[model samples]
Target: MTGLFTFGETMGLVVADGIGPLTYARGFSFGIGGAESNVAIGVARLGGESCWLGRVGPDATGALIRSRLEAAGVRTIAVPDPTFTGLMVRYRRSGEFAHVDYHRAGSAGSRLNPADLPPSELREAAVVHVTGITPALSETCRAAVFQAVETARDAGVPVSIDVNYRAKLWSRFDAAPVLRDLVGLADIVFASPDEAALFVDEDDLLGNLAKLGPAEVILKDGGKGCVAQIGGERHAVPALPVTVIDPVGAGDAFVAGYLADRMAGAAPEQRLTTAIAAGAFAVTVSGDCEGLPDRAELAALGGGDLRR
Candidate 1:
């Protein structure tokens, strides 16, 4: 079975080089970013076998996404579509703030359909991961996420979900039920305290989410730390101290860390430790997935300078 299997829309990213207004930005760099693909790359970097299934426009941007995933050791199951690929433009408004604009409505990625999933792949996956962002894209994309989750579940594959709520994509009123249902079906769930509040009371966040049916529920508190209930046992792990370069993909990195370790047969405590280490690696670099650590890099995280 594949160590990890995921499907979602990955967009071409155009980011300004220096910190300033978009109008005055001097240079730009092009890359790809998406929740599922980021996790796939992260798992692959940590020596886990991962595959990504998705649709992309028949354009250079789509090609970039496919090439990058393959180069990172992720198997890409990409389908060509007629609509244009999605794009995200990001620029630092100031030293402390980054502004982002998405151009995904009616794009090929938002056109994902349930028919695109391969049932054979779902059946052979060790863990199937989904994010709430995909369902918020469009009705067809929403159906696709459900179909993927259901197929994986029926095949006895573990289902993992990240409640990656995006205010720009949907309203809380519209997203709550869908996210709640997904959480109910997931075997493992990842959510922030804010995201959990969409379904359950904040007083007993993880407990309420677990009542929804997941065997494991994790509340990611960003730099502070994370709390989780796995197999009915509570585990809390503090975040590692690291310089924050860009926190864009840290959550995905954390998910990948846990999933990779779980697939490698690590205990719950060790899984949390690796997850924290992976998140620290993500924030120490600028691009999404660029700093995801290999086993060696993770081992050398707090080590002193190398001897030549």
Candidate 2:
């Protein structure tokens, strides 16, 4: 059985090879980066059968993303458009501080429509995963996400949502209401502490989010670790301390790990531990999803050893 199905926009990422502005950089490296795709890749890396549904340009960058995801064992269903694909430039100074520039407006992925999705593909997945990013792309894409979620929910397939808030994309007319409605439709919700702080009002962000709707809620707090609440019981999972390399896709990695564990019938506490370990491994490596660990690597991370 397939473990997960995710839909979102994947863009070509250009990163400066050395510490300087994009204009002054001597060279660059190219990769793919997108919240939903990152989580799908992470799940695939952990031996889970995951599929990614999205749109891309009929260009080399789009071809590269499709090929890379296929190589990583993720089943990709990509709709091709004539427009140029989205591009993001990442700049780092001293390999510490970082900044990103997005050139995604009018990109191919943003042109997605509800008609692009195949009903068969949406019906076959165990869990349908989506994020706040896709809805922010465009009105058509937003409608498509709602349709996908409704289909999945109606078919008795659990829907998982990652509240990946991007302030750059949020406007007065978008975001808040859409995200709240999506959260209500989701069976499982994942949120970073900072993102939760933005939407919910409570001293304990995790607790507040659980009250919002999702049957299960996972709260990620970077190095501070994570907490999982299910059936009114809360379990705190401590973070695994590791040398930091990059923190970009850690949250996505954590979601993949947590889902993988849940698929294996692991308890909530165990799932939380695996999730934190996955996120810790993610921050220790450079690339977005490349840092995600396999099943064996995750198993080797001793329990409670993060305190060391």
Candidate 3:
């Protein structure tokens, strides 16, 4: 069976209960959040096989991450380490403002090395998906990502990369060269217009990104939908109209949708349609992976509410 293989840091998340000052918030909800792992879950929910590999601390939080991924139908390869799992705290400061704090420096996930990936899985996967977040974590993690991409290339597997750049993690000066190199190595690349500007000219974002070497280039423009160049085809897919309760994880969902269909040999237009629908579903719910829709749900999107 065709599958998606991914690796990255899945961190413990602590989110304040209600909107307002976190100090006055009475309670918090615990969950897991990670870019690659979220994509794995999204693919699985869309009826595609997916595997996630990462380093996890010897703590309850780490166990929770593994369990959650398993529940979401993703195969997990969690490496145990003495270092603590990473943590991210999020809270809504107001109706429109949300604040996030990261406590992930030197965490176990940051300790990922090239040795963590199994050669067998790397060779067998239909596509290897990675994100900019892992390489930004630490030197070892960066090496691991590079190693995975190289290995996938050697095996003739397609590599998909999402430039999910976090300004809080590293400055553009430090990230530009590294991300540009990764884009050059990828078969398919996903990024926002702003993120693409970090490496290419703002005038022709899609054209410039394709020039960097990726045969497939996608600009995930959120509510504006996406503009993609796949092989010799150019697509402008629109987003499904929906009330967006939370916008986080929508990119991961979009990536997952495209990859799942790509693995199934779907046409470019169908792939983009599924990507847009999945992203629309993600924004209608809360949490990182909880909102990812399955194949059946994708069919019901934008239709009447009553389902027997």
Candidate 4:
């Protein structure tokens, strides 16, 4: 049993060194990536008892992901299956942008079914964090997510949802209904500016998302900062300026930081500040969740307000 629990696919990432297309790149670095796992890692780094639940291929990539997560203090509950592991290849061009090529079809995570996750494990969690991406994997995975959410809700545990909308994963027939349902059940909801724009059809993004079912809503805007609405009182927090090395996992870090602060009994305004600082710290480091700030580091960045 852990204070925080999250479940989703964790994919192996191969990022090209320097700047070029994946085909032309001669060097690559290996890492693990997934929205839920990233949040678990962030929480673990902040000294929280976080557990990650998922299915992975009984392969080297799965082993690596499990090992790395355990090393970061995250308890991993992985179901092993003999399926090809999911992989993502990232291409970067200096002064330009980065793109990802996903090879996730028929991957082990996409094969996760409700039977794969034990109800006992989910029942023991204090808070269950899920994201929109997991449901997009496959029908069985979608069912698993719904079951997990329902189980958590039935147990009277808090459920946090991140609406990480990836257009490439879902056709028009898939996303809207699923996301809408999830939002209606969440206790806390996190979404970026662009994602919020798509989910809640309003020009004033944060204002629109706040009206959704979640008692607490956080709208993250890169560089510009973040805004939160808790109990009808809104707070806006500015982003800390930092030299960014990579932008991946910033949102996950923010969610983890906010949750950690909330669990620590911090005020809503302080939680927003801590979340912003955590996200700023994440982008300054190379790996996803690697740069997530500990309490001291967070305090140095004015996140000390969390103690108020």
* Model 3, span 1-308: residue lDDT tens: 35999999999989898889989999998999999999999889888899999999999999999999999999999999999999999998987788999999999999999999998888899999999998999999999999999999999999999999999999999999999999999999999999999989999899999999999999999999999998957999887889988788899999999998888778788888888998999989988888999887888895211211
For candidate 2, write residues 1-308 as lDDT tens digits: 46798888999998888776667888888999999899899888777789997789989899999998998989999888899889998888666688999999999989988998877777878788999988998999999999999998888888899989888888634677888788889889998777776667759776777778788988888888878788689888778868888888999999988887776677788778878888888888887778888877776765312211
Model 4 lDDT vs. the true structure? 0.84
Local distance difference test, per candidate?
0.91, 0.84, 0.91, 0.84
Per-residue lDDT of model 4, residues 257-299, tens digit only: 8888777777898778878888988888877666777878888
After superposition, candidate 3 runs with Cα above 4 Å error: 303-308
Model 3 alpha-carbon miss at residue 132, Å: 0.6
Model 3 alpha-carbon miss at residue 211, Å? 0.6
Q: Is candidate 1 or candidate 2 better by TM-score?
A: 1
Q: 183-252 in candidate 1: lDDT tens per residue? A: 9999999999999999888888989999999998988999988999999999999988888988889999
Q: Which residue pairs in candidate 1 collide?
A: none
Which one wins by TM-score: 1 or 4?
Answer: 1
- Clash pairs, candidate 4, are none
Candidate 2: 10-residue stretch with minimal lDDT: 299-308
Model 2 sits at a Cα RMSD from the real structure of 2.9
Cα TM-score of candidate 1: 0.97
Work out candidate 3's RMSD over C-alphas: 2.4
Q: lDDT value for candidate 2?
A: 0.84
